[model samples]
Target chain A: MSKKDKSFEVLMGELETLVSTLEGEDLNLDDAIKHNEEALQLIKLCRERLDSARQKIDKLVQSADGEWQKQPLD
Target chain B: MAQLPELNNTLSVSQITGHIQHTLEQDYGNVWVKGEISNLTRHSSGHWYFSLKDSGAQLGSVMFSRQNQSVRVEITHGMEVTAHGRISVYAPQGRYQLIVDQMLPAGQGDLHLAFEALKKKLDGQGLFDPTRKQALPPYPDRVGIVTSPTGAAIRDMINILSRRFPLAELLLIPVKVQGEGAAAEIAHAIEIFNQRQDCQVLIIGRGGGSLEDLWAFNEEVVARAIAGSSIPIVSAVGHETDTTISDFVADRRAPTPSAAAELAVPDKIELDNRLSNLGQRLQKNILNRVERHEQRLNAIQGSYALKRPVLMINQASQRLDNMQDHSLRMVKEKIGNYGSKLDGFEQQVKALNPLSVLVRGFAVLSKPDGKIIRSVNQLKVGDQVQVRLSDGEVQSTIDSLNSKKK
Candidate 1:
């Protein structure tokens, strides 16, 4: 899938792999540090995604064009 | 004719009616009658009177306080009940009435025969089978709520979902949740949700109420709607004990509206906590790896070979250094021995050189025939002799030299 279309589950998989790569025995110190840095960035992004999420209520209202469009709920 | 002696005999009305009543009671001791109750009334004396009517006829029925006390249910309009009593006649009114002792509601316990029939039918079709139930998504992106917009249920659900997980979007499809046309509205809303793919799941219900108030959810249309929905539907029809047909046909049944909200999405806080736990594990793994590397470093640093690297190198180089001096002395000694032997050989070679005799001022004579005159007997007296010096040779006739004995 496209990067932007990646779900939280996909991102979680990536995060898990990154962490394991960092901890792997065959990994060199520089590569391990690099993987750890990338994992930390992913963790930060995931945390932000979770913390900043807000539920929005809306209704599917039929407009004059005979199409259902989203309108904010009261 | 055999006993006609009483042709002119006239009896009193009370005595004749008493005999008739006794005969009627003796003929029909007890009977059960089933019909719809109409024109029911409760008298001031705690007596219940009604008419049991069928399409063909109507029977006047009366349940006195003494007899009606045994009846479990009250006789009401349009209620078909099977009553147990006897047929009796009132002589004064000259009309027979049924004296009901016990009454049992017949069509159903409380007008739910249709409900049972529909449930049986739908169940026969496997609509309510557990296997047909869909598994709800663990993390729904959006949830559509098909309920009355003005109800506390929607408000409670919205509030619950928001508080539990704010990640999922809520799409409210407003509809009447009760009364006329409510079932159609509910079904329409579900259809819309399915048609538009509005949300991942649908939560359909109203607040708790009586069966009459909650009839819309019990409707066949609503049940069919729930069964046909492409999206998984969560029915939160009424209180926990109240199960509507919608609840039976739904993919999942939530006892309360707030519980449906809880079922529709994952709790973000729990997920966040899990993510944080994962992050900690990730860091712990890295720390463990780095600690292993550091331990290797400590091992190398504390090693004896590494601690005294110069000594380690010196031990290897000392073998080569000792061999270098030995090889150098052997080479010089062998060369000196060869040099003495070469001088002896040079002296022997010099003794064989004729040029050495010239340097010593010695001369040797030979005959012109290149023969040395070793003996006078071998030489002619007039032979010329040639004398050879170190630097030059003179050519002459050989003369007799002396014979020498060596």
Candidate 2:
């Protein structure tokens, strides 16, 4: 897998694991710290993915020559 | 016959009917009858009375509480049934009736078969697998509902979800839930929701209804649509006992549409309580960790290595003490040596004492005013002088005065 894809997978896995861990009781401090760190990493990865996707969409929309246009945020 | 005498005998209807009832009960035993049921009535006394009819004839049937309790299928009009009972006469009513002992359905209905077929088809596709199901998001950002816009189910779901989790955004994907083309519309709505990505979770359902009314959810198209969606779907089609293929394919199945809403979103109050609990737990964990580290630190600080400052300082203290003793001894020795040198210098000074000079017997002269006369210029004509040897002095007068430049 590409780095982005790998990161995406890891992000999703980390999110799933975090949710499961949070659903349970008896959390160790070490585990909590580890999960929190993982969640932060996943959130960063997701943001990056979203930004890249937005960039790709913008590029596609810009290349298209048509009356329909994408509007820019104020 | 001897009965010919009854030509003149009078008899009441009840009396004659009781006589015939006694005679029929004595003649026939219990028998089973196959016929179509009609005009069924259930009395408050837990008894069922209906007319059992064939194409050629009809007869009244009665199923008492004791025998009716064993029948599983409901007795409805025009139901083909086989009933086991004995033909009996009602003495009071003067009417003949069949007392049914047992009954069984003779054929399956079209709707029941259709339901089973749909259930089997969805089951074969692993759509009903519990492992393939995704859990509902604890706090969905948006909840999409697929149903009739003006339906009671929608209203119920809205009311429930809003009351339970008011923070969630609700989006309605209105579509016909019944009649022709409803299944297609529902499928299209689900696809649209998936494409829009406007909802975190989807609840596809309608309120309770008859088999035909809820048939849209049982359609294969709707079931596949639910199963194929990227977003997790919750199916709540009918009453608790009612099942549909959509329910099977959905990630979660709720008994009713309102229940599906409840399942789709969590109660804000409960979540707040849980978050507060988590906060408390986090605090407790941190405090316990700090306490444990503090105990370890206290144990380390209270060790013998730290408790006794002398242990660490003992070598330095000993070195200081040794240096102090050595310095004191050197000072004492220096003092002794200085004392001897001082005695030698004292002896030398005594050798050069003026008293020793006096013991050498040098004579001295002085004037009477206590002036020493060292030359003849000191001797005036009227001056008085004293001549001194080493121990004594003599007073004398000068006869002449002389001036000298020396």
Candidate 3:
């Protein structure tokens, strides 16, 4: 999935599901390896999403054109 | 006559007044009076004197300065009030009046009524349905706050949000949280937040206040606005004990403005810990998976087929050699039997040889004409006779014939 579409929750959910499959008894060697790889990718994505976040504040303003706009909450 | 001073012995005014005073004090002591206050007067001594009057009658009352200070409601003329105190008679005036120790506005009217009415109306409309509450996003990109621009509530919320989750952006839509147009202003701010896409959540509230001060939050307009907002709204109006209509209708209700700030976003420390935990779990789980697979691989590699391959080959070759030795031994035994049979046949042939019989001393006789004669008459003509023995041939035909015939 695209990074924009991959919410932390969704990626984490998929990662958990994959981990369980990898831990399951029925998974063959090749499939387990594949699941492990995918889980790592999800972890990386989630970590990046968390680490890169920065806090901000904004003020919402209405323009003469009858549209809403955001300005810095100075 | 002197009949007990006319049976209704006219008592002295002092006696009658004292008796009346005693009766009034005893009977009307610890009384509760409910009426509207009129002729209210605040004495220069910080005392209050008011007449608790309804349409029918009025009772004079006095609350000492100490008592007035203790009373929660300001005693105002025309305000309905309930007065509580001991009733004592002003014996000189022959009137009984209450010495008021406490007074309360008969009901927490206006604001309280408005709050209740709005709550009921909204509740009937299902605006306060628990199921209608939106789930706040675990991680909101931005939050919109509808509150006063400069207030303790805002300060508290800002500090909390910054410390809790710096990852979240805040959208502060400053509005009056009390007074004349506060309700409309709050509603407008909510609408603005709803129209904007930046804020995923909203916190609309103010600090603690008296019911009147907190009336704006109880306003129907604000309640409906909060209920209608697309973004989830957390209402943190007044203190913990206070509940406003907005509180009922909002997606979530925080007891205080500071609590609202806490509810707005997750604590960064907690999120950090959680993420680290999740990372560790992932690592451990993946490692376990690898370990299991490695074990399987080791098991296969340790199997007899894969291990000790040279031993297998040696065993097969050894069996082949054993078969070869067995085959060779069988062939040799058969050949020896055949050789023994051949030897016996050769001996038999040797026994039947004529050369061997001749060597046993047998002889043959023959005439000179190369015909052997056995009869004496044939031998009479002894011109020449020849005899053959095992060693040599000889002729004695005449002598042999005479002796045999006699």
Candidate 4:
């Protein structure tokens, strides 16, 4: 998969794993923290990708309007 | 009115009784009687024997097991009934009795009819829909109970609630649960509990009894009160088999008053175990975090960059030393070779000097006017000239000279 799609898949997988782990209530403190950290990173990456996509859409809109806009996606 | 004289060789007692029984059976065939049933007995063989009586007259009745099995309504003592049967005589005892085959209730009270009509009406309204019922709270903060203050249901509710979940507060709203105006009183109690806002769940019920005893709960007022309450209500009226209108309209239905209490709260032991498990999970998480950080720290400390701090510096220093030694040797060799060649060139230049040539026994001839003499024609007679020798110079005047030969 492309890097963006791969990241998205990883994020979704981590979310499912987190839900199952929390629901199962069998995780040790260590495992919970590790999973939590992984979930947080996945969330951050997903958010970043979403923000980038939003910026790209904004750029497309501005280009359609024939305007030179300097928008930085963070 | 017979006037015949009795003889010693007359008919036996059995024959005489059979004759009388046959006559009575033929005379009173297929009769209907209305009377109160008394001394009712149900034999193990499923037959019924009872006496149908008025204020003064009474008659024995027998319902065969086969015919009695078809009786839909319950036959009980003190119940007035109208029965259709054939009057027959038993030859063994010569007793005449009614052999009933069909029966009907002589009279039904107004209260019983009203109870049945209300029950049917409420049932048709879908008030007893199980899908509309709400689940009891797992842990109610406060439980409100509406019943008679002296009833057994309240006691059962309180006992079960306290034993199962002592943390829950019980709020009892004492009201008459039966008889006249009991329905209104129960409804008012429910309204009061709802308006107070302190109770999270409500239980409305009473002990089990006959239809009349539970008529209050069957009332429309009580059912509407339960349905209108904002709080979730659990109806536990009467026994498991007895149903009331309030039970149908309430958010939940319990088989008994004690069961309602059990449903309203959760077990404390189970909750405690859960909390402990969560605590353990938290600790494990913290320890795992620490271990991961320590592993990262060890990895960093063991990295090559830190272990060999002077590798780059040593290599650079050695290179600089080798370059200096190489440059020094090159310069020394070049300077030494160039110095010897320069000394030889200087010696040749000195040998070509005029003074050195004169020293080697060569002379430069010139006229007396200090000009070098190249030909005799250019020289004048008696011209003073200076001559330089290897070790000295001579002054002389030239005489006239001619060129004799080339």
List TM-score (chain A only) for every prediction: 0.66, 0.53, 0.71, 0.55
Reference-based lDDT, each prediction: 0.83, 0.75, 0.80, 0.73
CA deviation > 4 Å runs, candidate 2: A1-74, B1-36, B39-45, B49-109, B124-126, B304-310, B318-378, B382-406
Q: Score the docking of each candidate (DockQ).
A: 0.36, 0.07, 0.39, 0.02
Candidate 3 chain B least-lDDT 10 residues: B397-406
RMSD of 2: 13.1
Tens digits of per-residue lDDT for model 4 on B213-254?
A: 888987888877877788889888899987777877898888
Error of 1 at B336 (Å): 23
- Candidate 1 scores a C-alpha RMSD against the true structure in Å of 15.4
- Model 4: docking quality category: incorrect
List the candidate 4 regions with Cα displacement exceeding 4 Å: A1-74, B1-43, B47-78, B81-113, B280-406
| Candidates ranked by TM-score | 3, 1, 2, 4
Put down candidate 3 lDDT per residue, A1-74, tens digits, no spaces: 68558655566577778777766678776776677777777777766766786668777666899776778876
lDDT of 2 by residue, A1-74 (tens): 54454533354455666746744657765776666556555555554543343111100022256332333211
For candidate 4 chain B, the 10 contiguous residues with the lowest summed lDDT are B271-280
Q: Chain A in model 3: its TM-score?
A: 0.71
What tens digits encode model 1's per-residue C-alpha lDDT throughout B1-406? 4665675686678878888889878876677678999999999999988999999999999989887875645567998887777889888898888888867787433435566678989999999999888888776778898998887898999899998878778998888898889999999989999998857788999999866788888789999999999899999988897878899999999999989898888787887887787778777877887888999999998988787987767976998888898898999999989998999999999999978977799876788778865556766667677778898887776455566676
Return the number of clashes found in candidate 2: 0
lDDT of 4 by residue, A1-74 (tens): 54354633354455556645744556665676777666555555544543343111011012577553433211
By the TM-score metric, which is better: model 1 or model 2?
Answer: 1
